[model samples]
Target: SPFPVHINRQQVVHISGECCHCLRLNNLGIFRIHCHGQRGLIEAKIFNLSVGNHYDIGQKISFQLLESYEQLRQFPLEIFRTSLTILLTAQLRLVQERIRDLIVEEKSGCAIVSFQLFEIAAQLPKNEQVINILRNLIDKQAINLIDPNRRILHAICGSLVIGPKGESIDVKLFSQANGDYIGEFTPKKIGQYRIDVTCANIPIQDSPFFTEVYDPLQVHIGPLPKNILIGIENTLEINLDNAGNVPLEVIITSPSGINVPIKIDDILTMKKVHFTPTETGIHYLNVKFGSDIVPGTPIQMMVNNAHIISAYGDGIHHAVHEKEATFMIETKDMQGDLQVDIEGANSVIKTTIDRINNSLLKVTYIPVEVGFINISIKWNEKDIMNSPFTAIVTNPGNIY
Candidate 1:
């Protein structure tokens, strides 16, 4: 006999399963489970299990079956999760590296230009308006690539180049000083070169000035003593002519090759030099310049000033503080008269001198003439010292 009962109204549904001690194969197998709440139906599969040595909950499963299920489900899922984590980490690292590179590049550009956005946006090819604005700025001399302190005013990590034929591009600001800038530079291999202009960690843009180096001025030795005797003091006169516009400092080296400073009053003109040589016997006279001298022009000379003038000539000339002068005396072996003229002065004194002894003779004053005091001595006819022993005469006022 079965009693009809509504599980929902009773709030319970009970099902009973066979105990582990049962022996019959299908002899009255009763499975039972208690159901509650909104759904009161007991499911038969909830408590179904095969009879084993121990109760189903306490049964020990084989390692092979457990390991197979783990490999097919949990183990594979764990491995897949680990692989996904590794891939995500690698992707994050790559993205970080790219971001770092971009930051470095941006910093480099910012170090040259004050406006970061201006430089970055100006580089884009699609920004035609920006390019045009930059062009106009250059034309208006609004951008300066050089500073007043002789520093190169750089753009955003780059240099400017001018072609042979094109509009005059101004890289300097309008308030900058106007001057000529010439640059002729070339790299061995074509590559990008960075230019940076920074002041107090901030960047500034100015004019682009260029410089070139030319052939240095050379020293040509003219008339000098070929053989130098030892233990004798020699006087050397170096003639220097500046061939370049740039002023240069002359450096005369000694026996130890130590450079000594030489004064240059004016570099664009010729200069006369006079110095005494200490050592003899083929001493090397090395001359250099602190700055670049004139290119392809005679800049210096090394020669003995003593060999050109006689040691007794200064005494025979007079008390006149005049430069070395040449005189012409006509003597036909007997006697003759002469005339004298002075430059940059109104006085001229004519005097006769001995041919063999070269003693001074009495003379009178003359009218106004050039500063050059020229005197002519004459005899009958005789050749002395290749031409004549004509000597420079001093002004009467210069007599002591």
Candidate 2:
């Protein structure tokens, strides 16, 4: 009697048979037959067995078993063979179903690609030998697979970073103890970057990854004031725009070679610095963000050296007609030429200026008639302190 036995694909079956004859027999003929489902014999092995001897045979067979009665009744041998072939083929197929979380930071040039490899049947092997081989491929040929001219173009493996002049850039690879692979490279330029990865001589899904590289600290200093006054507390305000969150070192030197005190305040991406210059001259400012020099650095500021301290005279309040009124002016380290003028209603007043010292000046004016008189003074073609002095003029007899 023949009995049906079910076995998985690639499973080995062992059969042994021994013959006993009534009469003493030297040898006995034996035939081992294999069939798939209800189909006729598909394979056979013949052997000669001696009396009281046993013969054993082991064979690994696939696509030669029955699974269901319907399949046996229908295409019988064909269905069994097809089912076994499909199972065997699936067991031998290697598939990379999902590649997860591929990330790259352009500024840091760090890239990570994580994926898992398994059989088509979703079966994981106990050993990760296949994963190791795939990792090696990703490490060696990943960049090459994406960029064939990597050597000539200087393309970094797993990353796309070109120099300022489109030159090749060097990239460094990192070893990961985990199953994930990571590649790192410092980009020399700022722009969009792409990373490609390959595993087991095959490109993963969405093989090329993209990212944007930008300067960690982007700085912009506002336009400097063209002119600054001297001798008074003058404030120079500069607005700094910092895109990156980093501490900035700001230094300002006055024209007199004195360090100016600076105050910095942060409000979101905008940074404001207030600088007060004590001396008058050309001032320079240097700004840096973590050792990186800010654009438009070493800004220059011009400080003008001219101001008035005080000015007062007798003619400032009252002036006599046809009489000379004297006035005195005091300045702080005054320089250049000085001029004085006086004018009244329908009356011309002659004015004379005398420099008493570098910091002092005397003015005398004679009014022709009694009226309001205006006194104008200039220093170096510029207005003096308390310039355009007004005076009430009246007849000498009218003043009691």
TM-scores, all models, native as reference = 0.23, 0.31
* Candidate 2 lDDT, 7-94, residue by residue in tens: 8774222211221111111212121211122211111211121111211221111111112223233334444334433332343343
Task: Write one digit per residue (lDDT tens) for candidate 1, span 26-75.
Answer: 12222222233323111111111211212111211000011122222322
Quantify all predictions' global Cα lDDT against the true fold. Answer: 0.28, 0.46
By lDDT, who's the top model here?
2
Per-residue lDDT, model 2, residue 173, is 36
Which pairs of residues collide in model 2? none
| Model 1 Cα shift for residue 197 (angstroms) | 10
Clashes of 2: 0
